[model samples]
Target: MADSEQREGMHYLESLPRRWVTLYIPLLLFLFFLLFPFYWMGLTAFKPNAELLSTEDNPFWVVAPTLEHFKKLFIDTSYPSWMWNTIIISVVSTFLSLAASVFAAYAIERLRFKGSHQIGLAIFLAYLVPPSILFIPLATMIFHLGIFDTRWALILTYPTFLIPFCTWLLMGYFRSIPFELEECALIDGATRWQILTRIVLPLAVPGLISAGIFAFTLSWNEFIYALTFVSASENKTVPVGVITELVEGDVYHWGSLMAGALVGSLPVAIMYSFFVEYYVAGMTGAVKE
Candidate 1:
């Protein structure tokens, strides 16, 4: 029996190297593919415009590094206004979405109201409708409301979809939480609002963060609606402003464009990195429970 066990252990040890190699090869390749664009963007951001345009200069290596592009982007252009507009719209819209979704979700998930389940389903289905189809009608509404070409247009329009998806996500997460906790609080004479604010909201932090991050990123990177609603340069978001204003009449400002994109994406990247674990945990917990 000892000899047989020793042989089995040796076989398992030999198989480990093969299994590790198979797993690592694909993982390394995937990482490379995912990160190469970021690497390219960083290198391009520092490269001089001449080097950027020249085929002789290595695309991966910056021969002549300069801050001229960044200077031009910040000082010589309207990038600051664009960035500010994007930040305000994204933050406000995300906050509004969170506030609306949490209460709506709690109602749908906990309160036994008539047609609550149907309403939840309908909201989720409406979220599934693509923005491409809705943008025209939305544009008309924005125009009618006289908010076209303004940042408030984005703030108002973003929540229409964000609220629905966030509501559904929060509903799932809220349902996963045990009702016994709320029941205990209710027995102690806590009002529904008190229980929600004191207990439920605190417990649902992970889901809230995930939902907020999603909403913020969506609002920040949204291009189609930004383009359709805002025509003025001062009111444009980062995504639309960078593409339209930077690249005019085939004179593409590659270095500045890449720099702008890199900077624009940093906030979302930082947000995701901070809340990534919570986002995964919240989603998994909601699904499993």
Candidate 2:
């Protein structure tokens, strides 16, 4: 009877105040940290230059929001072109990386070849090597290939980083699938290519979405390579275009800068909203394996 009472006491729910301290407060703080930047960007985007410059008005809330910054962003600047370039680069790079990663990861995980584990580890390590260092040699190659200052530079270069990470991610997810499934396909006289396309690819949709999302996000936000390889205003991605085109010398266009950022972030936000389930599932499966 005493042990039963002790067990009940141990398993009892916490009081509201204790729960607030242990869970609710920390969750609220995390949400604030994560969401405050977006809120600030939206607030800054709509505020008039007078309100932005003046100190009297409450910075948290905009009293008189205007479309002037957005107008300038869309009309006065080459934002549409930047948006287009970003989309094209991100899409092409993501697809290319996913395609390559599918094959590489399948081979590493399924082929059961010698040193496959070592090779997989090496690929992930390659991803850890910062792009800051790789860009120098990459820039020279881009120059030689005569793709410098062009969209192709970004499209081609993005896969260099994207593939390794995607391959690593897909490798983990692939390992989770039972090998017996592949064995049955092999016994049924399915060719490796046929098995890959018909069996493996179909089962790995969530992993593919997760890897694609990651590759797309990286390509979209990549600034250093975009800045170095593409000098032309029209070819620049959103990140580079906004910073280079909006600010001149000592002056900064905070309103327009925020507008560009808010607009630039929408696609990624929409993507996450749509595929968040698959992303979580893929990561869970990968980690479990």
Candidate 3:
């Protein structure tokens, strides 16, 4: 039945012209829009300053490509330190958020406590609160703790936003899991920790991956918090550091800026490319549940 349905769908676009107008053309246009930024950045990163400013050369294509921008970004700037700071903060925050989210999700979904539904709704609502508002109070707290202008500020404050969303995403996925399994384990005198470790966690790997990816990406790209919290050039994350350090008064290092952006985006892009399948499944499963 499915094969026949697929064949019927294919029949509508069987002709070359029909397929071109209905499928290939639109797909090509979408791909172009999606990938154009990366292409532009890559070209800009390799182009020399002269070609970049010259109207004589084609803007879309490179005339003389040079590695000087990359060299400057690496050798003359604190980009490496910024990158290391981003990695450490993102990874540590992601781990912390996921840990808290797991417990929160499991409790709300499986504990059968009073106001569980309300609590779950509240958690999701917390996620909807804008970071712009929360950052003010967070900044004060970080300053009071004497952790301002340090990587610890970002690592600690990031979970404030990350936990709520991760919890919400995980709650839905946890709901998709059968309650009967936990009930069976309970009858066998298994502890909650045991059941979680030996059963639920094993089954929830996709959900965990999805949550981890979301948390990591958010932490990596986070700018306002990183900027407001950390003032030191070496402590800034990629997003904040690239913008603050590369642009001076009425002058922008376009080549190095593009190089930093291009390089900065690679980690998240590679992560998505690898885990896209699981990410989709986790999102769909959670939403359906």
Highest TM-score: which candidate? Answer: 3
TM agreement with the true structure for every prediction: 0.90, 0.91, 0.93
* Residue 238 alpha-carbon offset, candidate 1, angstroms: 0.4
| Predicted candidate 1 versus true structure: per-residue lDDT over 139-200, tens digit per residue | 99998999889888889888988898788788877877899999999999999999899999
Rank by lDDT (best first): 2, 3, 1
Q: What stretches of model 3 exceed 4 Å from their correct place? A: 1-10, 282-289
Give per-residue CA lDDT, model 2, range 203-285, as digits (tens): 88878888888789889989899999999999999999999999989899999999999999999889878988876765565
Q: What is the lDDT of residue 246 in candidate 1?
A: 94
Indicate whether candidate 2 or candidate 3 has the larger TM-score.
3
At residue 214, what lDDT does model 3 achieve?
78
Worst 10 residues of 3 by lDDT: 280-289
lDDT of 3 by residue, 114-205 (tens): 99999998997887788899889999999999999988899888998899878988887777789899999999999999999888888888
Cα RMSDs, all models: 4.6, 4.1, 2.1
- What's the CA error at residue 148 for candidate 1, in Å? 0.8
Model 2, CA-based lDDT: 0.90
Which is the winner by lDDT between candidate 1 and candidate 3? Answer: 3
